[model samples]
Target: MLVEVKNLSYVYSEKTPFEKQALKDVSFVVDEGQSVGIVGATGSGKSTLVQHLNGLIRLKNGKITVLDIDLSAKKPDLKALRKGIGMLFQYPEYQLFADTVASDVMFGPLNFGFSKTEAEEAARRAVNMVGMDYDSVKDRSPLELSGGQKRRIAIAGVLAYRPKILILDEPTAGLDPAGKREMLSLIASLKGEEISTVITVSHNMDEIAEFSQRVLVMNNGKLLYDTTPSELFYRLDVEALGLSLPHTVRIVRLLKEKNIILPEVLTEKDLVAALLAYAGGRNA
Candidate 1:
């Protein structure tokens, strides 16, 4: 296993009256370079799980390993571990404080011990990876850019670190349609890299269905189901757990009722063609 978790559990304020259990013996493993999507309600331990991944929260119990190191043990080198896993939280743009976009994007690399020139080069490379123009946006103040531009700069900061694994929680939480599109496009492009694994928590069922190789769904601090997005969305158990099927999934299922043989994938364009095939085949 590239990343392993064996019976992990965490409690907030243990031995105190405000104590709350965040994760209860949760266990799973992610292979290298996999696209995993995590879905959960507001307080269903999603945030806690990702936080623990990058050592933001010290693991209090059970075995957690990433990149061949045990996180449960007393860690003497947290920074080195963090450099292997990049995490970007929801609404990350609100944290940008640098005078220029280049400065903000290079912050992580500089902190990782890269020299000024190396950091700037990494920042420019990452900016291009996120589909942003380094020349046009580098000198501009992060605050002066559009919302989409700010979001890109924030994501580029994490990318500049060149982490082997990427984890994002609710990455598209606050954005207009175009901004959301840009962010999602950048996210989708991360797949198929030889050296990195991408994981994200997304509420847009359509997005998950389209790009994710596997999905881990949670509700009420407990893991409910983990499966392929197409399989999970079509199951009655998912709908019973207060999750709705994506619009395209619902329409595709309706077409199946009329004897349509749709593609196995769950995507809007695929479903549209499947429905058209079913309707047209009916006349023959």
Candidate 2:
């Protein structure tokens, strides 16, 4: 396993009246080179859980082993562990403050002790990988770019360090259709190219269904289901947890109710193909 969590639990404001249980015995394992999606409604602890994976949140209880290092250990080398786990929070672009785009992208590698020349080279590669022209944008201010451009540049910053695992929180939020598609495509390309494991938390079921090999559903800070995307969508109570089925899955179900039987579909491309095949069979 590339990551392991056993009986994990966390609390916010532990000693205050505002104290609340944010996570309850959440446990899951992620294999190397696997893509996993996490889905849940608001306040389901999805954010808190991923924070712990990279040592951003301290472990109050339970064991978390990330890249073979025990996160629960006292005085664990958090900096070292974090270097291997690239976490991009919601609106990560808002965190950008460098004078130049290249500087922002180079920040991670430079902080990790890469020489100036090597870091600049890494920055250029990462910027290009995110679909930006390094030569054109390297000197520009990250804050001056469009929303989608800033988001991609922020991702490039994380990529420059070359982490083994990449975790994204609501990566496609607040983007137009085209921007969302491009961003998701960039994220999907990370596996096998730069990162070994990809974990993303999103409310978009369609994106999750299309991207992830495995899916995890969370409800009220509890892990409700962990299975393949197909299996997870098949559960009767999925919507009761405040999540909707992927559009393709719901459409297929509706067709089946009308006796237009078809194999399960998760993506728009799959749905179109299935419908075309069904139509052809009827004409035959």
Supply the TM-score for candidate 1: 0.93
lDDT for each residue of candidate 2 in 1-284, tens digit (9 for 90 to 100): 89999999999999999999999999999999899999899999999999999998899999999988999889888888988999999999899999999889999999999999999999999999999999999999998999999999999999999899999999999987888988988987877787878999999999988999998888888898898889988655778889999999999889989988898878889999999999999999
- Each model's total of backbone clashes: 0, 0
How high is the lDDT of residue 257 in model 1? 93
Where does model 2 exceed 4 Å of error?
Answer: none
Misplaced by over 4 Å in model 1 are 256-264
Which of the numbered candidates is closest to the native, going by highest lDDT? 2
How does model 1 fare in lDDT?
A: 0.82
